[model samples]
Target: MGVFDSHKSFGKAILYTCSAESKDFFKVYESSDDKNVILSPLGVFTLLLLYAFGAEGQVADEIVEFLGAANKRHLTDSYRKLSRELSSMDPDLLAFSDNVYIDNQYSLNNSFILNAYSYNSEADIIDFRNPKSAAKTINEWVSTKTKGKINEIVSEDDITYDLVVGLYNVIFFKGHWAVPFDESETREHCFLTDDFQLIKKPMMHLLKSLDYFEDEGAGVRMIQLPYKESKFKMVVVLPSHLNGLSMVLRQISETGLLHYVNRMNHSEIVINLHLPRFEIKSEHDLKNILPKVGISSIFHGDAYGVVNEAPVSVDKAFQQAFVVVDEKGSTAGAATGLHITYTSLTPTIPFKVDRPFLFAILYDDIVLVAGTLSH
Candidate 1:
């Protein structure tokens, strides 16, 4: 795919995939005891696309189908174009890194290595026998790529002998608000939790002309907040009812996030915005979750051909994400690793995010990070 090639088809496929998968993952988070959740759909999608490049037979087909791609070629081509676009952005505002770490004992196929390179991924051979050192090396790479927002994605315990190949992706974004929120305007406000309990939180206040929409059909309101000097923006989706997040999430799962975003065509209007200053850090074991979403074949010894001829299955898959939103702006980062596995608003129409809601950071139409905050 070249810069001139139309990304419409590719963008549609990825947006649907990211939206569905994010909803599923968020459900898992909701079921857990965690109060807030964050994950990068693009990071996981990129890793899986890399794995699909080396896959064959039904395994490849299943992944391609799940990703809503026409086939393996479509998957890789779309990723290449997306990678190029992200890389062309200002490094200080956004950064992305993809890598494959193989055990020194296993020799990856030359074609697979080349294909990985074409997708903007680097391949390295490391010794998994020394789990501690391997963990440190991988963590160091993740930390550097994410500008220290994500310090450690893996520990010694996460590295096992069964792990033959580890596919990793990291995305970091730090952007000042196009219209900065005045710190003096921020004050303590009441936030209603899912349990109907009121808690005090530092709320950032702003009044400006912003793109906004209210969907009576979806029972939700949305707002878009742009980042300074970048196409990236944060969209917040707040449900009318305090406990109605699940219903809104189901709507997203069905129509995709793009559907609601496209509906934000209302002209920019002046509105009051009260958004809580919050931070979220979450980690997940995807081995248990991916299968629930119809991506089961890769975990059952079907990932060998993509890396080496040795019979190996994914031993572990993990993702850790962090996001902090304050008066200045938002800084977010996430790291997704497949141990051979593989894996709003608003707005301003008095759009006060004083309750549980959904949020996403997007570049153009691509969903980078998404999560729920219900505390």
Candidate 2:
């Protein structure tokens, strides 16, 4: 069957895949003490899918399995259709771009490159040995794609002579709250942490009727705050207890997350929201994280198929993400880059992310970006 024929199922697969990956990512990256982290699991997954399309044998097999796609073609075709559907969307609310840079010494499979361009992802030939200039060029492409919010995805230190191919994806999002909080109502509020420490921060306040739910069983409350067109939303899942974030995070599995979202669809209530305005900028090397998520074959394996007659394996994979929530709306941008190296929620109810909590920016049911706030 065509991937698009099962678009609904494919979308669910994407959500489940990302949810599963996010749990692993949370344990490895966000589990540290006193860390605020944001991750674009969608961006990371897209780059990995592209690499898999160009790969063969065990590398492709593993990635295809991880992506929950029947095959590489199914994955690319599904993304191409998704991109087309998103192309007609409001540009200010969402922007997506993908790219690949191959060293001039190697030859890429034209079919694979064609699939990339079909989704508006361009392929450029560059000299990886000249890390300085190459890094600048790729970074410029990233900056342009992300409207300058993400200025650089690759630094000089991130590039090396062994780098054969680089695959990158950028997703930029800006959404205004359907019912915005008044700036005048914002006040300094005490936020309690897991350690029982309290800190004062600017807390935005609003009393409005919103889509809300409280799962007492999970000890969490959820709220859906829509953006302008209502095509996308920011969902917040706030733990009932001040120090219960760890429990909520630990319980975030694909099944549990889907259950929470399904439950939210049936509930609504008036909420006196007290949300803190916070900014998170995170950079992570997926070398440590992707392997934990069952994507180990691309790192040190004899990965072939993308290039002809070349022995190349992934060297490094990185992702940079940034999100800012303010009185008006939210602006988020993320870029995932792979250097042949390979690669790789929430709520609201009375939701005061005053302390630490989890949040997600989603287009319908698909989570585009997600993170934890531990301050």
- The TM-scores of all predictions, comma-separated, are 0.93, 0.90
Off by over 4 Å in 2: 1-9, 17-24, 28-34, 87-90, 254-256, 265-268, 341-349
Pick by lDDT: which candidate is best? 1
For candidate 2, give the lDDT: 0.76
Candidate maximizing TM-score: 1
lDDT of 2 by residue, 160-211 (tens): 8677789988889988888787999999999876567798889999776677
lDDT of 1 by residue, 1-375 (tens): 323136555566566544463434555555558758887888777877887877787778877876776778877776787887787677678888888898887788778889988767878889998999999999999989888888899989888866778899989988889999999999999999978899999999999888888888779899999888567799999998878887888777777887888888557687799999999998888777777777777787465566555655566777888899998989988899888732202333688899999899888888888888899
